[model samples]
Target: MDKLEAKNRIAELVQLLNKYGHEYYVLDQPSVPDAEYDQKMQELQRLEAKFPALVSTASPTQRVGGEPLDKFQKVEHHVPMLSLGNAFNEADLRAFDRRVTQLAAEPVVYICELKIDGLAIALTYENGTFVRGSTRGDGRVGEDITSNLRTIRSIPLTIQEKRSIEVRGEAFMPHHSFLALNKGREEKGEMVFANPRNAAAGSLRQLDPKVAASRNLDIFLFGYGKWEADSLPSHSERLKYLAALGFKINPEWKRCTTIDEVIEYVSYWSTERPNLSYEIDGIVIKVDDLQQQEKLGFTAKNPRWAIAYKFPATEAVTKLRTIELSVGRTGVVTPTAILDPVQIAGSTVQRASLHNEDLIKEMDIRIGDTVVLKKAGDIIPKVVRVIEEKRTGDEVEFSMPKQCPSCNSELAHLEDEVALRCLNPNCPAQLKEGLIHFVSRDAMNIDGLGEKVIEQLFQAKLIKTIADLYRLKKEELLKLDRMGEKSVQNILNAIEASKSNSLEKLLFGLGIRHIGAKAAQTLAAHFHTMDELCEATYEDFIAIDEIGEKMADSIVQFFSEEKVIELLQHLSTMDVNMTYLGPTQSQMTAIFSNQTIVLTGKMESFTRSEAKKLVEANGGSVTSSVSKNTDIVIAGEAAGSKYKKAQELNIPIWDEQKFKEAIES
Candidate 1:
């Protein structure tokens, strides 16, 4: 076919496939058979190949084409995705209804939706085209998962409405998908996911979109976010509008005029949830009227107009086979229960947390005794209590090990602490755990060096410290299992790249006693050099915001250690960058210095990270949201919401050309 003919045919096929896909994946109704669908999809792919320019991201064949990302880029949400206060019992629901009545001041109408047990994701569409998708990381920021989300058939690539909108939803793995995935994993000798929620989350977080596509995940658009105009009076109507826009929303939602009706819906779902193909942990009750919801407003963490009525936690009685103790990075010895196989929350419960010696003693949990296990909201099951009535005389009492399990060093319990800790810094268990943390995403972000590889390297005695990772030779790596020449080279490159990372990453990766990622960032931003930070006294650390007396002491103690000082010297000698590379206002560039700038859309010359770094390196604060406070908005090709917001707010605007010129000047 000619280009024009191919274009028209492609459009027709897209419409047919979208319709068929919506029916099959969202509505659970199939109009076309698998063979027919496959034939049409093949035709579309061939046509697109012939007319390469016609290949759109929204095209059916383009759903899963992308390189496996080294890491996900963090995207800050203009609006925060907040959590909900949970109502466990009928009394909590009643109390929630009473609070809504008192606060809303208007007659309350409620919209109830099944709280799908899965990962919450936000999808952003610009002029009806799906542009971005992200996990609700800390609500303020999230990891970009657009490629993975595109593979989901239920999520439309484009809508009829030509408006920029942000949709929030729960991405879930259905029962059949979960079972099939686990079975496949078992056959491959890979550890199977404990629950459908975990499977869904794991799929979404996969670096490769093809892997996510194979998982067959689905989504239910629950609400809207960051939309400029939403004139629908009630949330129920908004849901209808979203459905009209070709977005998949849960069909089981109901509008309740009274709390009694809401309660009925919750009660109905509590028992009936088991019958559904997908998993749901609770019922979300929200005030139907948008205006009323606004009037009721939100608290610090959750909305006052909404509450989640959690189904009572699933519990099962199982025999406590034995308690297993594991050492952690911090040297804290944790106790886990190895239980007799019993089904709880639709998963086989073979392992549960015993939570240290105090908890075991407190519950009087003896081995071979019947124990009640509680699985709450798909979280790891915990040993709730021992069934004393069912206990036999032959049951064995468990005791905590007095010595470090790995090194045989004597374990010491610090005063005011319940759990025993292994103080040996050189303990193999501690080093392994610390190495894992050192290479984690939030830390040094060394790709290819994952937990399994770290364990292997540790066991091989090739790496005992974080610095040893930098010293990894390509030759030595080739000797390891599954380490091909290409993979080893990639790992070496990643290790090399991590050297230039901002000091905050190195600080967090160091596994200091009380220094977390945020605290590390604060410290790095303040001192700007590792040597300076090392010189910081307890008083100096205490003066910083968010650093408490305990953290300050910990920092001082950590830096004072001779081993830590030597480690720093070794890393520096290996050419690892120790100076903070992030922006400081005292730096040059009058245009960007101290300015809060927003960047939007695609840049031909620079990646988002490259642009962000340059802007930061020039002493500008690169913000995600555009508002009256924004000093400038750098509009790249096809700039979207932030550009429009900047225009609306009359903020100073810069095209990519102007931005480049300014930075160069």
Candidate 2:
């Protein structure tokens, strides 16, 4: 076909294919067979390849996916994706309804929807063409996963309505997809995902869109961030309009005129949820009237007009066969109950966390006793309680191990802490866990060095410490099982790349007793270099607002360790970065310099972390709570107790926009 003919034909094919895909994937009703859709898509692909100039980014053929991305870019949301407060029972729902009614001063109609247990995402369309898609990282800023999202057939590349809009939705893996994915992983000898939610999240976060497409991810658009169209009066009407605009709206949603009706809907779905192909943890009820929703506003973290009624966790009774102990990177020994295989919340439960020795003692848990098994938040398996009535005289009481399971080192319980810890710096279990932490995503982030690879290397005696990872040669790596030329090169490159990471990453990777990622960042920003941090006195650390006495003591103790100092020196010799590279305390001493600032509520432009970072970068110190000494309080939507407290203290308050302008200035 000629250029003009190809353009018209491509447009026609795109519309037809998108419609068919929507019908099949979203509505679960296919008008055309797979072969018919495939033929049309193939024709479109052939024409697009012949006439490359005619191809558009939003073309249906592009849904097959593109080249892998190096990393996801950050995208600032135009509107904050506020999280919903949860209602556990009928009373909570009633209370939520009462609050909405009281605030609106009218009888409020509610829109109840199945809260899809999946990753929340925001999609922005420019003139009906999908422009960008992002993960709701922290409400305001998110990672741009546009390429990955495009692979989802339910998410239309172009909407029927020719208008700029931003819609929010849950991207999920169906039950079949999750099962298939886990089966595939099991076959490959890879760790299986715990649940569909985790599977969906992992698939979406993949660097390659092809990987995401293979996972068979789907989405249901529920709400709009920005709608540049004719105004809708109610949320129920908006849902209808969204469907009309070729968006996938969840069919399970209902409109309730009264609180009792809402309660009925919730109760009906609580049992019916398991029948659906997709997973849903709860029911999300929102005020039907948009005007009422607007008036009701939001709280610090969630919307006041809506609340999620979470279904009570699924439970099963099983015999506790034995107790297993494992040591974490922090050297804390944790007990896990090995149970007789039982199913709970759609997954088999063979083991559950006993948390610590105290939990076992408090619950009077014993091996050979019947125990109630339940998923904490329908994710992690936990032992709820012991069936005391079923307990026999032959049951064995479990005790905490006196020595480290891996290294046989004496374990000591720290003062004021419930967990008994192995104090041995050279503990093999601690070293292995520490190495795993060092290469983790938020730490040094050596991409190809997964848990399996780390274990393999440790077992083979190839790597004994974090610094030894850099010393891995391609020849030696190739000798290991499953380590091909390409894999070795990728791992080597990742290791080399990790050497340039900021000091905070290295600090966090060290697995200090109480130092977390955020704390590491704070310390890195404060000290600027590893040497400076090592030289910093306990008094200097405690002087910082966020650093507590425990953290300060830990930092001092960690730096004082001769072995740790040697390790730092060895890493330094290998050209590993030791300096802070991120935005630090500015020397300019701007308006916010030395000012105690507290950020509360949800900001449209900046997430809480971003706001805190910004405040600190401008020489300001951010505090968690409102205090008498607080100089300023930046309050956003639904600023609750913090705002009220700020008002009481007569402290100056700034809105999100105001804070933005100040930071910009």
Candidate 3:
């Protein structure tokens, strides 16, 4: 066929195949037989290969496209993927309803949906074509997994919606797919995933789109984010319209006019959950009206407009095989119960935290006893109670060990603290655990330096301190068992990259007593630099609203140590960033402070999210459209309606150059 004819054929085939796929995957109906679909797909592949330029990202053949990615890029969410609050029982649901009613000063409608037990993702489309997809990482930032997401049949490459849009959804592995994956992994002598949720999450994180496709991942669009001219009055209509746009909307969602109906929906799902094909751990209840949702607004963490009624943790009786202990970064030794493998809440319950000796004594938990095991919050495994009736006379009581498991150091039970800790500063386990925490996702986020690599490094005596990580040489790393040249290069690059992370990461990575992530953030924002923080007194810390006496004292103590001061200096010489990368106290009220800005058209240097972050960090807010209230419009090349609206409204307009200069100034 000629190129022109092939192009027309490709377009025709693309539309036809997409229609068939939507019917088969999303609607659970097939317009054509398998043979016919296969025939048309084969024809499309041949035509595309003949006219290579005709092969497009949206082509049916490109679902599992290209080579595996070396690494995933970070994407900041335009609209933060805020989490919903929880309602455990009938009273909690009623309380939520009362709050909504009180705020609206009228009866409010609500939409209830099954909270799919899977990973949350946001998909962005421009001109009705899918462009990017990402995980809901820390609400504001996420890993870009657009290639993996494209492999999911339920997600359309193109939609009927002509305008740009962002949609949030749950990506999940169906029960059958989960079973098949586990069976395949077991056959291959690989570690099988514990549950479908874990399986889904792992699959999406794969560097290869083919691997993600093999897992048969699916998604259900839950809601839209930052859409232009969103005039839909209610959430239910929005869902229906999204479904009409060839998106997969879960059929289980319901619109309720009263709280009683919402309660009924939750109650029915509680029992009927077992009958569903996929896993759903809870029912999500959201205010139906868009106006009501806006009126309710949000908390610092979660949206006040929605609540999740989490399902009760499933219980299983299993014999406690043994007890094991592990040391954390702070030297706190934790005891875990190893039990006979038994299924609970869709995952195998083989281990649970016994907490400390006090809990063990209070509950009288013993090995060789048939104990009742339940996952805490349906996530962490925990021993709820002892099945005393099922316990035999031969059951042995568990005792806390006196010596550290890794270093064989004497353990100390700190005053007023329940956890037995290894107070020895030089304990190997503490150092090893500290190294792991330092590179963890929420800390420095050195992606390749996982627990196994840290342990390997510790065992080899090649690294000892957090500073030693920055000192790692490629030649030495290549000496390790699994470290190939490429792997070692990536690790070194990641380590070097982490040196420039914002101050909050390093503060949290330090593992200071009584200072958790939030406190670390507070300290970072207040101190602005490590030098400033090092000189802070307990009084200085206590002056902050959230910093309690204990946390303040811990912060003061941590920075006062000569060893820590030396380490910071050493890291600084290695070119690590010491100053705060976020908004400083002085810059908080800069030129853009308290202004509402709108972005339009194509950006040359930074992405829309990147620009938004810049504006927000310096105390400006980014809104969707230009209006009389809009303080400035950051117009880029091919600036569209928003730019025109800014001119019409007599709002200030700035090119990217001016916006950059003003922010920098």
Judge candidate 2 against the unseen true structure and give its global Cα lDDT, from 0 to 1: 0.87
Error of 2 at 479 (Å): 2.9
Report RMSD for candidate 3. Answer: 10.3
Candidate 1 lDDT by residue in tens digits, 461-482: 8999888998889899899877
CA RMSD of each candidate after superposition: 9.7, 5.4, 10.3
Error of 2 at 319 (Å): 4.0
lDDT for model 3 comes to: 0.86
**Candidate 2 Cα deviation (angstroms), residue 346:** 7.5
- lDDT per residue for candidate 2 within 266-316, as digits (tens), equals 888877776898888889899888888889887555778988788889989
Each prediction's total of clashing residue pairs, residues at least 3 apart in sequence or on different chains, is 0, 0, 0
Sorted by TM-score, highest first, which candidate order results? 2, 1, 3
Clashing pairs in 2: none
Query: Which has the greatest TM-score?
Result: 2
Score residue 359 of candidate 1 by CA lDDT: 84
lDDT of 1: 0.86
Q: lDDT (0-100) at residue 498 of candidate 1? A: 95
In angstroms, give how far residue 88 of model 1 lies from its true place.
4.9
State candidate 1's TM-score.
0.68
